[model samples]
Target chain A: MELNIYHLYPEHLNLYGDLGNVNCLKRRCLERGIEVNVVNFTDDEKPDLNDGDIFFIGGGSDRAQQLVYKDFLQYKDVLKELIEEGRAVLAVCGGYQLLGTSFIDKQGNNIPGLSILDYESKYTGDKRIIGNIIIETTLNLEPNKLVGFENHGARTYSKYQPLGNVLVGRGNNDDDMKEGIVYKNYIGTYLHGPVLPKNPHLADHLILQALRNKYGDVESLEPLDDEIENKAYEKFIKLYGK
Target chain B: MVNVRSMIALYAGKFSKQVLKLINSSGTALPGKLALRIDNNFLDNIEEKCDTVIMVTGTNGKTTTNNLLNHVIGTRTDKILSNLKGANMIQGIATTYVNNTKDHYDYGIFEVDEGTLRSVTRYVKPDYILVSNFFRDQLDRFGEIDNLVEDVYTTIEKLPESTLILNVDDPLVNKFTQLPNKIIKFGLDLDLDEVQNSSLSMKNCPLCEGKLQYSSHVYGHFGNYECDKCGFKRPNPDFVVSNLEEKASSQMITIDYGDEELVFEYPYTGIYNAYNVLGVFTVCKQLGLSDDEIVSAMGDFSFHLGRMEEMEYKGKIIKVILTKNPIGLTQVINMISNDERSKTVVHILNDNPADGEDISWIWDAYTICEREETVLHYYCSGIRAEDIALKKKYDNVPLDKIKINDNFKEIIDTAIEDDVEIVYVLPTYTAVFETRDYIENVVKSN
Candidate 1:
C-alpha cells in the first residue's frame, strides 16, 4: 500500500521537532510494508488533496504562525474539502490552532483559521501551559492513553468534541479537562513531543485510518515488538501521569 | 556618591560569599541574590565601578565565547572581572559584580543568558555586546527564539553606543544590525557543506518571512543566506574565516579582518568551535589587541569542562560532549561519526529547568540516528531517558540496541562489557555535570 502525506508549511511552521511526526509516520508505514511518501508544502504551495491520504501539520513559533497564516488563507477551501471528504489529518499545536475558526495573537488581534473545525484559540496571558501531558483517548472504540509534552500560550475552546479527556496535565485550556479535537477524520492536539513516536499506537491508528480510507476494510497491523516502546511509554506514564 | 543601601548590599554580599564558601557551596548566585534583595540598585552601583563591561549571549557557546573573551582581554590587563564560574543569569552576573566591585576592575566580561539579557543590561551599560548565535534552545523555559530576539533587541535599543559584534551568518542575529549601532560582523566564509549538517532551525527569513536561500550553512542557522523577496542577504563579515581546514584534533584557518589577514592554527575539534574562534578574534581586533597577542592568548586556552572533554575509564576512552540543543547535539554526533572505532554511545537527557523540560528537540537532532553503523550499543540514561530512548527506537535503532536506565554507572558498565574501546557520552546541561561527577568518583576512581 502507498500513503502520500502532505506536510504543510514545513519551512515556517515546523518547530519543536515537529518534523519528527512526519518521520514517525514514514518509518512506521515503511516497517509495515507500506510505501509512505512525504511531500512538503511550504509558504504559498497548495497541497493536492486527492493525492494526500494523511495531512500532518506541526507547531511553530508565533512569528512562524503569522507567516503560515497568510498562506493558510489561499488553501483553506481545499483543506475544508479534504476535511469534508473525511481525509485523515493530524494537526499539532500551532497547526491545531490553524485548523480552528480563529486564533488571537498577543496583541488581541484575531488571525483567521481554516474554520473547518469548530474551535477558537486566544493568547489569554503571557504564561504558557507547558509540561508533560497524558490524555485518556477513545478512538476506534479502544480506550488508551496518549503521553507527550504541551508548550503553548493560547488557550483553545472547542465547540466540536475533543480527541481525549485530560488524564494528567492541562489540556486544550486550563479550565477544560478535554484535550485535542476529533472532527470527522481530522485530529488536532497540543501534544508535541512530536506526539507520534512516543505513542506508536496513535501513529499506527492514523496509518490504519489512512489505509482504511483508501482500501475500506483495514485489518490489524502486524505487531512489531514494542517492548522498548512500551518501556518508554510506561515509564513516562508512571513518572508524569497520575 | 554610593547610597547607604548599596553599602549594605556590598557588605552583605561579601559576608554571604565568605559564609557560602565555609559551607562548601559554590555560591554562584546566592551572594548576588542576597545582595540584590538588600538593595535593588546593587548592579547599577557595581556598574559605576567597572570602566568597560562586555556582555556575551546566545543559545549555545556563551560560556566558551565568554571564556575566550576573558582569556584574550584579561591577559592584556589584570583589572578584569568575569563570570567564569558559569553563573550567567542576573543573580550570577550580579554576584560577579558585587564581589568584585570593591576591586574596581577596568574590564568586566559577563556571559548573559538570552532571556536575562534585557534585565541584566538595564543596569550595566556594556562597552561591547557579543552575540554568539541563536537556535531553538530550552523551549520550555525561554519560550521561543523570537521572544528571545525581542528581549535582546530591546536591550540593544537602549544601548546604541555599545559596539555590537554579531554573527552575520545567522539571519536572526544578522537582523539586529538593522538597529542603528556600531556593528562589527564575524562569520565563517568557508563552504557551508564543510560545517553544516542535516539539523537546521531557522530556514525562513525573519524579515520577509520568505524561504531562505542558503549559499552555505556554516552550522545551525549560521550561513550565507539571501531572501529574494525582501532582498535581505548575509552581510559581508568584518572579521571572517576566509579559509578553514580541519586537522585531526585542530583547525587551520586564515582570519581576514579588513586589510590584516592572519593565518593561525586553532586547537579546536568541531567546526562550530571555528566560529567561536572567529568571534573571539573579532572582539580582540576591535579592542585594538595586536595579532600576535590575540593568537598567543587563544592558542594557550584549553577546554573548560563537559564540552568535548575526554576521560579514561579502565581501558575505554569516554568522550564527554555537552549537548543541550539540536544544533550542539548534531555537531557532536557528526564529530563522533567521523571516528572509525567501535564505540558505545551514552545519551543522558534531563528535563530539569536547565535542560529545557520540553524533550521535543531530541527528535530534531535526527543525526543521532544517522551514524548507527559506528555505534555498538546505545545507553540512554537520565530523568527523561525513556524519551531519548523512544526517539532513538523510532529512528530505527533496533530495540535490542537501546538500554534505558537512570543509573549512569550501570549504563557505563554495560557499554564497556563488550570491550568497547570508546564510549561517547552525550549529555544535557545538568546530566553533563552529573556524568562528569559520576566519572570522577565511580567510573574512573583510582
Candidate 2:
C-alpha cells in the first residue's frame, strides 16, 4: 500500500511545527509496512493536487500568510474538489484562517481567504488567545478528547460541523466555546502543539481516512504500541482535562 | 536640583534594595518598579552623573556579553555599574542605578532587554549600543522577527551620537542603513566544517525583500551575502575571526585586525560564544583597552550556572546546557552531534511562561543527523518530555534509542549508567536551574 501527502507552501507557511502531522502519518504508515511519499509545494512550484491522498497545511507569520495568499487563491477550487472526493487535510492556526472566507491580519487588514469553508476570522482582541488547549471533540473516535496549544490573535466563527468543543483554553473565538471546523475528512484547526504527535488517535484517524481514499473500503489499521503517545496524551489530559 | 519626589523615590528604592539584600534575595526588578511607580520619571536622571554608558541588546548573549565587558572594564576601573544578575528590563536597569548612584559612575554598563530597548533608551543615553545577532526567540512575547528588527531600527536610528557596535554576520543586524551613528561590525570568517544549518530559511533580503545571495553560509541567516536586485551586501567587519580551534576546556579564537593578529582564549566552547566574545572585544578595543588586557579578562572569567556548565559525576563529564528557543536548541543538537566523545544526551523541554508557553518553536529547528558513531542513548525528560521524545522519533532516531521519563534524577542516573565519556543535559528555561541544582547535589554527594 502507498500514500501520497501533499504539503502546501512549505517555505512560507511552515511555522509552529505543523510538520508533526506529516511525521505522524508517515511513521504510522511505515510502521504498518506501507510506502509513503511526501510532495511539497514551495512558493515557486505549481501544485498539482490530483495524485495526493492527503493534503497538509501549517501555520505561518502574518507576513508569511500574505505571501502564501497568492498561491491559495490559485489552487482553492482544485483543493475544494479534491476534499469533496474524500482527500483528507489537516490545517492549523494560520492555515485554518486561510481556509475560511476571510481573516484579519496582524496589521488590522481584513484579507480575503480561500473560502473552502463557510467561516471567517477577525483580529479584534487586544491580546492573543494563547495557551495549552484541550477539546471534547465531536468526532466518533475512542477517547475523543484532543489536547494541543492555541496562539492566535484573530477570532474565528464557524457554524458548520466543528471538530470539537472547547474544554479549556479559548477556541475559535473568545466566546461560543467552539474550536475547529470539520468538513468531511478535511479538518481546519487552531491547535498546534503540532496537534498530532500526542493525539495518537487523531493522527491514526487521519491516516486511516487517507488510506481509505487511496485503497477503497480498507479495513481498520494494524495498531502499534502507543504507550509513549498515550502517556504524553494523559499528561495534557491531567493538566487541562477538567 | 532638589525635587522632593525624585529624592524620596531614590531613597525608598535604595532602602528596599538594602532590605531585600538583608533578606538574601536576588529580586532585582522590584525596587526599580517601585521607584518608577512612585516617580514616573525616575529614570530621567539615568545619564546625569555617568561618564561613559554602554547598552547591550539582542535575542541571546546579552547577559554574557555585558558581563564579559564588565569584567574587562573592572580590570581598568572600579567606577562601574551593571545589571550583572541579568534582570535586564527597564525596571532592573533602574535598580542598578538606584543601588549605585551614591558616587559618580565612569561606566554605567547595562544589558537591556530587547522588548524594553525603547523604554530604556528614552531616558538612559548610551555612549555605545552593542547589537548581538538576533535569532528566533520568544515569538509569543515579541511578535515577528521583522517587527522586532523594525522596533530596534527606529530606536537606534535616532541615537545619532551613540556608536552602534553590530555583528556583520547577521544580515538582519547589519542591514540597518543611513544611520548617522558610528557603526563597527564584527563577524566570523571561518567555516565550522560541520552542519551549516541556518535555523531561518529566509531566502529574501531583509532590507529590500529582494533575493539574497550568500557567498558563505555559517549559522542561521548569518552569512556573507549580497542582494542581487538592491545591491545591498555584507560589510567588511572591523573585527574578524580568521581561525578558531575548539579545545577540550577552552577555545582559541584568532582575530585578524589590520596587521595585528590577536588570539583570545575563551574558557567556554560554544560557537555562539565566539560572537559574544567578539561583540565585547570590539567594544573594549573602541574603549582604548589593549588586545592583551581584553584577552586576559575574557579568559579568567567564569560563566553563570546553566550556560554550558560542566560537572563530573562518577568519572563522567555532564554538561548542563540551557536552551530556550529553537535556534539555541538546534545549536545544542549540532554541538552534541559534532562531538567525538561517546556520550548520552538528556533533553528537558518545558513550556512554562519563562520558556514561552508555545512549544511549537521546537519544530522550526533542524534535528540531529548522522551522529551514531559517538552518540548513544537519548533521554527526554521534563514537563514536556514526551513531546521532545516524539520529536526525536520524527527526526528519524530509532524508537529503541529514544527514552522518555519526566523525572530528572531518574533520567540523569540512567544516562550516566553507561561507560560513556560525557552526558550532555540540555534543558529549557524552566528546567535549567533545577537540572543544574540537581547535578550540583549529585557531584557534591559523590
Candidate 3:
C-alpha cells in the first residue's frame, strides 16, 4: 500500500527543522516496504489532500504562522474531512497552533486557526513553557508514557477537556495544562521536530495504528533491529521515568 | 589607607579566576552567573580607559581565527590581549580584562556571539572587526538569518575606520566587505571537492537581491560565487589556499600569499577548516608574521575542546563536533555522510530557551544526510529527545534503529558501545557545554 504524507507550509513555518517530521514519517513507511509519496505545500501551491494518507504540519515564526493561517483557510475543509476520516495526522509546534481555533500573536492580534483541533492557542503573558516535555496518555497502545521536547511561546487553552495529561515536560498550556489534542486518528502537539528519534515506541505506535487502519492488519510491518530503540527507552526511563 | 569595601572590590577583581574555579566545581545551575556579575563592574571601569578595541565572531571557526590572530600578534609583540578560553561575550571579555593588569592589553582579540555581537561591540568599541558567515541558527533566540546580518551591520556602522575582514563565500557576510573601509575579503576558491549545488539557504545574493551563480560551495554558504545582476563576486584573498586536498589523515592546504607560497598541513579535516586556517594566515600576514612563523604555529594548533576534538572512549574513537546551528551541523553531517563506514549519530537538542525555543531546525539537517542505510544507530538525547526522535522518524530513519534518551549518561554509554568507527555528536550551545562537562567528568573519568 502507498502512504501519502502532506507537509503544509514547509518553507515559511519550518523555522526549527519542523520538516524533520515529514522526513521521519517518510523514512519509517518506506522501510516497511510501503510506497510513500510526499506532497509539500507552501506559499501559493495547493496540494491535493485527497491523495494523502497521513498529514503533517510543523512550527515556524509568528509571522510565518500568520502566513499559514491565510493558506490554511483555503484547505480547512479538506483537512477537517481528512481528520474525520480517521486518517493519521500529526501537527507540531506552529503547525499545532495553526490547526487550533485561533492563535493570539505577540501583538495580541488573534489569527484564526484551522480549528482541526479543539484547542485555542494564544501568546501567553509569559512565553509558553519550553524545555523537555513528558506526556502520559493511553493514545499509545503501549503502557509506557509518551515523552518528547516542547518549545513554543503560544499557550493553548480549551474549555472542554484537554487532549491528555502532562506526565513530565511542559504541555499545551502555561501551567501543566493539557499537552495536545488526540481524537480519532489525529494527534497534534506542541512538540517540535526530532520527536520520534527519542521516542521510538511512540513512532512505532503511531505507525502501527496508521498501518492497522489502512491495511486492517499490521503483520506485514517488519520491525528492524531494536538495540538502539531499547537503549533509548532505558535511558528515558532512567532519566525522566518515574 | 583603603577602606574595607574598597579592598573587597579590588580583591574581587583579583580573585576572578578563583571565583570561576569555585563556580565550575560547585555544580551550580547557572555557573556563568557569578562571572557575568563580577565582569560587569570591572568592564564599567575599563571602558573609561581603553580607546580602541575589536571583536571577531561567528559559529564554527571563530575560536581558531581568534586564537591564530592572538598567537601571531603576540609573537611579534605582546601588544594584544584576548580571551583565549573561548568566552566570546560580555562576561568572558570582562573576566579576561579583570584578570589582566589594569589599563593593559592594547588590542582585544575577542570572539563575540553573533546575536550579542552588536551589543558587546557597542561597549567594547572595536576599531577592527572580522565577521565570518551568517547561517540559520538557534531559531527561538536568533529569530532568523536576516536578523543576525542586520545586527552585525548595525554594529559595523557604529565603528570608526574599523578594518572589516569578511568571508565573501556568504552573500550576507560579503556585503560587509563593501563598507567604506580597509575591507579585507577571504574565501575558498571553488575546487573539485566543493559541492556543486547550493543547499536550502544561500539561494540569492544578499547584495543585489538577484539569483546567485555559484561556482561551488565549500559547505553551507561558504563558497566561490558571483552575483548575476551586481558585479559582486568572491574576491581573491591576500592569503589563498590552492590545490587543497585531504591527505590520508591531515589536510594539505597550500597557501598562496601574493609574492610567497607556503604549504601547511592541518590535523583537522574538511575544506571548511582550510578556510579557517586561511583566515588565520591573512590575519597573521597582515600582522607581520614571517612565513616560517605562520606555518609553524598552525601545525601546533589544535581545537581546545568541543570542536572536532578527538578522543578515545571505551576503546572507540569519537569525534565531537559542536553543532549549534544548521550550517555547522550540515558541515559535520556532510563530512561523515560520504564515508562508507557505519556511523552512529547523537543529536542533543536543549530547550534552555537560550539554545532557542524552537527545535525545528533539525529538518534542514536531515535532508542533507547522505547515507541512511549505514547509520547503525541514531541517539537523540537532551530535553528534546522525543522531538529529535520524531524528526528522525519523519526523516525515514528506521524506527527501530533510532533511540531517545533524556539522560546524558545513558546516551553517551549507548553511543560509545555502538559498533561504529565514526560517532558524530551534534549538540546545541548549552548542550555543548553540558556534553563537554559529562565527557570530562563522567565519560572521560571511566
Identify the superior model by TM-score, candidate 1 or candidate 2: 1
lDDT of 1 by residue, B231-270 (tens): 8999899988988887756788899877988898867778
Best by DockQ: 1
| Cand. 1 Cα-lDDT | 0.82
> Please, what are the lDDT tens digits per residue for candidate 3 over residues B118-163?
6676566666677777777665565456657877787788775778
Q: Give TM-score, chain B, model 1.
A: 0.93
Error of 2 at A155 (Å): 1.4
Select the stronger candidate by TM-score from 1 and 3.
1
Candidate 1 Cα outliers beyond 4 Å, as residue runs: A44-47, A140-143, B194-201, B369-373, B413-421
CA lDDT, candidate 1, residue B17: 93
Q: For model 2 chain B, where is the 10-residue window of minimal lDDT?
A: B192-201
Q: Give the docking tier of candidate 1.
A: medium
lDDT of 2: 0.82
- Worst lDDT window (10 residues) for model 3 chain B? B26-35
- Residues A88-143, candidate 3, lDDT per residue (tens digit)? 88777778778888886656677788887677887657754656566776564454
What DockQ score does model 2 reach against the true complex?
A: 0.57
- B407 in model 3: Cα distance from truth in Å? 9.5
| Alpha carbon lDDT at A119, candidate 1 | 83
